[model samples]
Target: MSIEHDAHASGRPAITEGGPSLPQERRLVTAIPGPRSQEMFARKRSAVPPGIGTTLPVFVTHAGGGVVVDADGNSLIDFGSGIAVTTVGNAAPRVVERVRRQVGDFTHTCFMVTPYESYVEVCEKLNALTPGDHEKRSFLVNSGAEAVENAVKVARHATGRQAVVVFDHGYHGRTLLTMTLTAKNMPYKQGFGPYAPEVYRMPMAYPFRWPGGAENCAAEALAQVTDAIDKQIGAHNVAAIVIEPIQGEGGFIEPARGFLPGLLEYARANGIVFVADEVQTGFARTGHLFACEDEGLVPDIICTAKGIAGGLPLAAVTGRAELLDAVHVGGLGGTYGGNPLACEAALAVLETIEADGLVERARRIGDLMLPRLRALAERFDVVGDVRGRGAMTAIELVVPGSAEPDAAVTGEVARRCHAEGLLVLTAGTYGNVLRFLPPLSISDALVDEGLSILEKAISSV
Candidate 1:
């Protein structure tokens, strides 16, 4: 019944940078997937694994700013950002320029074998930009999952402990170790059992679905986590407590105000490391360089990716020096961990974020979206809740009279949006949330048009 805002999530309007020269417009030239995409889908059915799924199989030939152009010539307004991977926009001018140059110079020479200055420079930037002013260290990896796994390894190595704690509705990743850390079941953890050991789950302060009500969510959720950690895992046994500042695949859920700080306090009080998995929330997606900066909640380790490198596959684990240093010299690394092309792309992403003032742009996006979604909620009873910070917003769909999730309706609305040439993504644990992650480079005109299409889609449904 109570609604609060993060004061840090508002600012002056932003002047976004230019990225991807593709014309930004929505034009549905054919049926949703189009014939070319259909052909590709048929090929995929024969060639690819069933486990690998897709939201819209439009067969993208080009993407930039706010539009993803399909092979059939349809230009769909993009609100998904390739699952929030292209925050600076796909084929961002800076990224393309840097990577094109880097590719000609050299591609891979793995950081471990030869090492590169770009890699070291990236670590320096991460150490400086991530939360906390303490002496920090950073190492690059290939994906968010790898960053999280490295964070866990660093925590365990530093604390000399065995157990790790995660929260309900939190999504880490799909790797064996991260799969064990994740809380979801069906798609992520169902048959992939015989999971790794020593990971515990805590209740997240998810206000909308908390047991009693939103008001009690913060206090109760905090108590439950501490109690569970103390009684079940024993405080001393916990090496790290990992959580997303804002849950992404598990439905962009932003925990109540007091919960994160409370958890951080407990972690510090015990000798347990606190890891902030900022994969989806980092890089100005949440109106701040890091989501933890909103509450001033500094974690011992922060995992970043998705938006870190425009569209490159790069991730990082930045943390207190002692923890990262605790890992043996060769304890952490991968064949493609800090590939030079990715490193160049990451540096370009950082430059683009700072130059474009994307943090302010994300704030402007939230200012534009939250009010519109809230107004839509008032018009439609199926809109159970509208929550998110900055451009990373979501609307939780529900049965008309109650909080029961309406995943069916969510799917239908998404399908409608696709048919109308609007690219949107559905998320949440129950799969009833529609999350929007527009590239910050997108013009306000495109954002308005996308929202209009979404409104029409919801109305039609």
Candidate 2:
């Protein structure tokens, strides 16, 4: 079929002529490096780095659906999903076609100078899709970090507050402000030094290790936060309480059910902006389009990225119209924040999510995987806790009953999983948690296959 015809069918303009799709049956003909990817990696290693390139012999010749075909022509089930950036799938047909068309027409005009319909359309979609019955607005950005930074800026600008409240084990981004907001210091904040001022950390309820167990964990955590916001950094002086509905990078820890609501209530009472850092948990990764939707506690601002543009770099802040509008005009944008290509891809991603029912797919992926992970936890002494929402699931590894993390074994498990033809990623302050970001478009068979491999890896570990 012609590209134009396919685009027309998919409700997008055509750009490139017919692009190829991967074969249905996965074929791993050679060792992962095969021959091609190794060559690319060697060439890249001289350019990339040992620190940057964690997965060695890394190069993908082709990827689609839930599998990555490496340069060696080895088809591996992709569970990391490009670090939760490709929820729909790698090279999703709709996203590819839309991006192609957009690139062909015009790539960058920089929304700051000459605005485009795609940017406006994406903002409109975000405003509509984001939780809340109140009037909403959106600001598009390049990456999750940028989105988060801008969200903080908006909150501070609106509330005229100097202090920001973040939770323990929370991760915002790598930027100055975001790094300050991030709880972990090593690597991200270590020597990165002199982080932005006024960023304070509070404890969060990790049911697995909360002093009072799940029953009083939420209340205890809430009391601690309320006290901090009320006494130390008066809520009046605090611009926002940034939180991840399901904490990412901090070990896929889901805040207790009432914890989020409690924080929101505190924010509402003190006129504090509640910022939901849905960077990793947004776009149906948590099964509800936005993880915040699970609690029905609408934040003053919602920072989103990762899966926003199907694979392209796109991030956004969606929230109350008044607060978002509070920022001075032109005070909240980047040169390539909402590039047309990214905007087109994002639109297609939203459509594909709706048309293809990917949110349901995420819920299904979670339903299928969680039980097995729970079972694994029961068997493994190091498996401290298995928790997460929807497709954004993780398993925290600890030393038996204690909260002491086992980063060594966690690293080993991840290494084994990768070697066994399954790509996985680890998170947490101690890096003892294995996070699963499988594509929502993944098939039941692929899910089962990946889990079986994971089971073997964990068993070996």
Candidate 3:
């Protein structure tokens, strides 16, 4: 397929094709999971374990800008971006070129075994690009869970404390420690037992679900969190307070204004490390390079992944030199932590974000999505709330005339969208939120079309 470099007025190349120049428009040649997909799915069921669940079982053969082509040749508009891992889009030109070059040079030398310059370069980029201007150091990992675990390890080593604090509805990762840090119990922590020790959870400043009301959420939540830390787990004993600026899996809940700043002040005064898990909100996905930037929050440590390497399995923990370096030598690292290929792809991804002005693009996406979603909320009583920042937006479904969560309606709306060739995702602690994470490279026309499909789906439901 011939790739064209059609630059927009903003100097960013407008991606109008999927892999092999697959047309950007949605095309349903067969029912979602056609015969071929069904066959493949049957094979997958036989080969893979039941623990691994799939949202849509269609077998994808190719994907790019804003669509994934299935094995049956059906083209579906992609709103999930593989859970915010492809901010620059799948098969992004820069990422592809860099990976190609790096693969030809050498695949992996194992950074721990033989350190490489690409790893150093990636860390340098992270230290320079992360929110603060302080002297920072970073270490790479293979996934968000690893990064979160390492962050906690560093915090403990630096502070000599065992207690780690997290917030309600926050998701860190799936590792042993991260799972303990996570708030949700079902599906994620149901069968898993013997979770990590000394992990404490506090109330989050969730505006829509606050006890009194949205207006009083921030102050109450701050007070509750402070009390929880002071009374439940003494402040001096706490090593770190980890949180997601904009909760991802727990719904795209943006904390009430002033809430994050208050927590930062408390953590600072008490000498506890304030860690922001930006796994899903980092890179240009949240308007700012990091969601904490919205409140000028400079966390002691920031765990980043998802959109870091254009869909590659890469993660990083960027933090102050004193905190990150406090760990003894050889205390942090993994075999595939900073694979050369992923490092190269990350460098390219960073370049793409800057050159494409994707941060502004994310804000533009939010401008287009929020009003429409809010309008839906106005029309449908089931849509209890619509919230999020930049391209990461969501609508929480609830029983009409009540705040009771309506997970059934959420599922129905998502199913309807899938049937119509739109790929949306569901989230939230109660499974009542419909989240949208569209690729920044997707065209406005495609976005409008997707929204139109979503409207019909919601109306039908």
Candidate 4:
């Protein structure tokens, strides 16, 4: 059921006279995981596997703006937009309208079995909206990992090389190939090996945790990467260099300046394709449409998903025409790869972003979040570092007077927030980075209030 708005907000949600609307306020009416949620969770414990994790055990009944109303009737302030999937907000008016119409018209014909105009139009949109202006082509998939795997296929097919380079602290996805591409070991890749072959790991230019110093991160990391490729794998044998412009699951780690451009130059010189895995940082979630745009990067291939379709499962691999076209017919696709409903949702999402100036909105979110978090850093000894851009901001928690991560404290802080009706998330190699991804539809008042809750949570912890 699509909820209508009061029509008075800045994001300008589609208004209707009467409906059960989501109020943009944080209200706690019961315990975090109150009786009703506990009942559902007990059933989940019996039916669901332990492998599937839950960030907050509170089951949601409805969500919109900056609020997620759980089964217990608790309205929690949303700082995590369903892991950055709902950039336009959950049940967005545009997405709801388009998807509802698409569902009525046709659910699925399978793009491969029967062609559709929406798929072709989405590809065209990807070509125009992505960082490159070069002639390009795109194919859709069901998730980010699938898009990445296809991108690698395109790279290998075009270049006739097998070696693919990935960075430390990078996360591609959970599928077999992408799990192998991911850097974390415990949750994502522990028992999933023997992993994909010919995938190499490179040191990230993570300024805060860089070995030598922040100032030397760019040059040294680039040098180390080039040296690693030349000696370990041989540049001529490499097919693609894949990276997250701003490392997502890896602590929102923004590489130091000059690192990405240097890598691109090296790849171009070495005949290797550059693939930017913009799964989390694309679609105006970052201040720019793509985070790579911050450095004027033009990747040979770019993958996007998270915020693409306003919560629908959709991902795309957009790259140079020569590369994607190099694959033989039927090399890339899935049954639900550009499902009409998801395609319509993606189109509507793009429309919302452009119309609402979400790119600027993302910048404003960053402007609102970074300062408050930095202020927290000043006052709290547990805060090791504060970083991120646009709506994707986070703080690294560490033991006072040392760089060692305080995962225990991080967990406690997150628990405190959840208990108080504020939904937050944790990440990082050490599990100490507290991340925030407020919806672009979130109001200034909600953002301020959420940050207040965050501050209180941190202080109490």
| Total backbone collisions for each predicted model | 0, 0, 0, 0
Sorted by lDDT, highest first, which candidate order results? Answer: 3, 4, 1, 2
Residues 1-461 of candidate 2: C-alpha lDDT, one tens digit per residue: 01132332232222223323564334668766567876787788789766564553668877776788876778888888888998887888888889888878988988888899999999999988898889999978999999989888888899888788998999888898899889998778888888899988999888887988988889998998898778887778988888999888888998887999988988899888899999999998988999988988788889999999988999999989899887787787878899899999999989878866677767777888999999998898889899987898999899887879999999999888877788888899888999999887666667788899888998897
Candidate 3 local lDDT, 159-188, one digit each (tens): 999999998899988889999999999888
- Residue-by-residue lDDT tens digits, candidate 1, 311-377: 8899999999988887888999999998899999999989878766778888888888999999999
Residue 366, model 4, lDDT: 91
Which residue pairs in candidate 4 collide? none
**Alpha-carbon RMSD to native, per candidate:** 4.3, 4.3, 2.1, 2.4
Quick one: best TM-score, which candidate? 3
Residue 405 lDDT in candidate 4:
94
Error of 4 at 111 (Å): 0.4
Q: What pairs collide in candidate 1?
A: none
Superior by TM-score: candidate 2 or candidate 4: 4
Better model by lDDT, 3 or 4?
Answer: 3
Model 1, stretches more than 4 Å misplaced? 1-19
TM of each candidate vs. truth: 0.96, 0.93, 0.97, 0.96
* Overall local distance difference test of candidate 4: 0.90
